[model samples]
Target: MTDFAVSYFGGRVSLRFAKGVPFAIAALVIAVIVVGITSLLAGSYDLAVWDIPALLSGQGDKTALTVLWDLRMPRFVAACLVGGLLAVSGALLQGATRNPLADPSLVGVSQGASFAVVSLIVLWPNVSIWARPIAAFAGGVCAAMLIQWLSAGKRGENSLRFILVGIGVAAIISAGTSALLTYGQINRASSALGWMAGSVHTASWGPCAVLAICAALCLPALIWVVRPLTALRFGSELAIGFGLPVGRAKFGVITLAVAMAAFAVAAAGPIGFVGLLAPQMAQRLTRAGVGAHLILSALGGAVLVSAADLLGRTIAAPIQFPAGLVSAVVGVPIFVLLILKRANSSQL
Candidate 1:
């Protein structure tokens, strides 16, 4: 049991872990390593597994080093970060909204980011690439606020009402994206479309670092909000009675969720279903509370996206599928299964 123990907040708090968690986390780590190696070795130019150690040590074949370090590594790292961020974002949103179906992709956050990125790309072609993330973040905030307003959060939380509003917001944003694509120049349209499909094909160290830094900065805030979130789960009245700042905590959690989603969208466009899938999978695998759920969700997200990206690249050889397409392909069935399970459990 001690072996499975994990600490949070500089050991000020201790949360017990399940007996199987260590094994599960270890398995996930191994899976990530395997995927990273596969990504490094199985690209357009294949390299021997033995060569990887040499490449890291600066003694491998020049071509192998170039392929591994410059091209594949950034993408591998980016995919991991994007997946983790998206999953954690989903966890936060699910907690904040008290809705299992709440996810960035479903609730208009990703669509809003997509719309913002496309609008800037088309309407303000002269804007710098660095500005896209900011715009996407702003768009995500707007989307969240719109959802809250439409759902009338001032009255109280209603899962069904919130989800319906999110769907409406997503539809409006999607329509705007389509209109931009419909009338924009062919060249710009194609580029936006590819980005929106969630390709990590052009991954580079700069964007990868950006994603890492953003996660690093947001993590402390997440930790701070976790306890409050757990309290909020009992209801705002109980949360307030417990001395939790319900409104501030809700804002913090939602803002963190939106920011994480925006970062993922900025890095790899709107990779569908990772945000939706990760937290749900994490929840199913563990009975631990919010903190553990968040960590596990991040790990699960990393695995799902990395595996999806690797499969996308290898399944069709020279012709590649975007991770988003793969996630959507895989996620639809999982989504249906979740819905059915929820319904059945409720019936019981």
Candidate 2:
């Protein structure tokens, strides 16, 4: 489809999107809304679909209101926020690194955040849950810095080196996290395990607000990176030849990505594969500019996570599965298919 550009702010800001992008984005938005409504209505504590209007209007049974507002609503919101953040993060990483397989978990952001949050849980159980995002952000930043330092040298940045170093760092951090889980107190470790499993069942309005605030704060950064991402995709040398500050742009993109992933992990634990899969899904759905691609990826991620959470809670009735587990189960086969597709393309 052809592209259309819209100018705003006296032409200082413009967004270009493919003709099909709007349709794809609308579809994803509808999917998210449907998943969210279904999540709110279907659960162990039944809430009739027809009563949703009354309940939302504040005229429902007290118990139903409590279940809807306090439990289901927050969980659904959290899933959307977390999924959107992670998907955007993954899109950024893939663009910045010029690696189709790059994602938060693959590149050490999730593991770093997990390490910090798990340490807090296992070592200082009395700390407020609100502190998690801060710790996670710090850990993720450190990890990103480490990867950058290790990957850059006399020849400048190397995408392959970056991915390799990040994989090694992620593995080390994951090992540390496992050790903490293994040696820590059983009760605290169990609590940490539940969070690490990536279940949003315990999500409340507090964490939901935090995730929303983080997403809002990242909005400008997202817009700023669109051009850089598009340029970077053509290769670092070409980006530099085009008068872009390749190093600064790459650093900024990676930092933005890390922050997004860290916030999501802090709020809902590390939900796997959403970041990895969403961008690919978006790309396959429509050929669009980076801005529209990111929008599609975020919406796709929200749908994936919200659906995963819905299925987790409803599929087995009272026996709930963690959304992470379900997403992995669904994502792994898709991931394998992506790998095979890439391999076949390279061969051709």
List TM-score per model, in order: 0.92, 0.93
Task: Single out the weakest 10-residue window by summed lDDT for candidate 1.
Answer: 339-348
Whole-model lDDT values for every prediction = 0.86, 0.89
Please write out the lDDT profile of model 2 over residues 300-329, one tens digit for every residue: 989989899999988898999989999999
Model 1, residue 15: C-alpha shift (Å): 4.6
Index of the highest-lDDT prediction: 2
Model 1 alpha-carbon miss at residue 322, Å:
0.3
Q: List the residue pairs that clash in candidate 1.
A: none
Residue 348 lDDT, candidate 1, scale 0-100: 16
Clash count for each candidate, listed in order shown: 0, 0
Compute the lDDT of residue 18 as modeled in candidate 2. 82
